[model samples]
Target: MNIKQSIAIIALLAATVWFWQTQPARPAPRVSFKTIKGANITPADLKGKPVLVTFWATDCPGCIEEIPHLIELHRQYSQAGLTIIAVAMHYDPPNHVLAMAEAKQLPYAVALDPSGSLAQNFGNVQLTPTTFLLDRNGRIVMQKVGVFDLRDMRQRLQAID
Candidate 1:
């Protein structure tokens, strides 16, 4: 094969890999949330709304750093049918979670996964600061494992009706 042909084949393979990585979104998992205020929010109640679900821990620096951004997201999008749920990992102490939520004045629901079932339900999430962005139809459009891109999130939020 010629040099140019080899390069072209490599490029085509790379493109195909990238395309497969962005598979079609899957339906939201069947998990319920118990907010710190003792309110229960089921997947049924969250339908027809753009939902941002984050698995976080009090001790995770990345998770803590994302708090302000999450709060702002809630403030800006809550009225427009956006539901942000911060699910605290079962390993985190409830007292620490409550204190963090209160200290930060988090505007969104802070759910506690006391048994880690919620995390398992959300694809056995084991990393802190993992985020799932769901469309209005309850299909997860994005699942990010680290710090999420703010601009991307804003653009996604704008499309929800």
Candidate 2:
């Protein structure tokens, strides 16, 4: 190969390697928030229980679309030591959360993070319906950005228990 071609190939390889290494590890950000039922929910509180933290906005279509699956997952897994804690990052007021939850008929425990503290803590949460699957030891195992798959979430929970 010509000198220029050889140099270009080497540069491309180096860039690819750098990009691969620089990718942020999946689900590293540990998040904690308060439950609407006047309880403190944190990583330490979830020890020995597989926890699913879902960040959702009431206005997002993806978030709204996944509500039924989320509800079913909670009903099926709650008895199995799996805890689903939903943190709402919707910009609307707290009353809006209640209204939305009531309208959606969501029975799972949910919390309002009005300041978007939980979302911000996990990183830039510009996307709606971001979820993190955490093992029994409170370590994040996987992160779903748009829509969460109940099957995948169940598999992760099985890994812990």
Candidate 2 C-alpha lDDT tens digits along 139-159: 667766778677876676676
**Which candidate tops TM-score?**
1
lDDT, residue 44, model 2: 69
How many clashes does each candidate structure show, in the order listed? 0, 0
Measured by TM-score, how close is model 2 to the native structure? 0.76
Estimate the overall C-alpha local distance difference test score of candidate 2.
Answer: 0.76
Which regions of candidate 2 deviate over 4 angstroms?
1-31
- Provide the lDDT at 144 for model 2: 68
In model 2, the Cα lDDT at residue 24 comes to: 48
Point to the candidate with the largest lDDT. Answer: 1
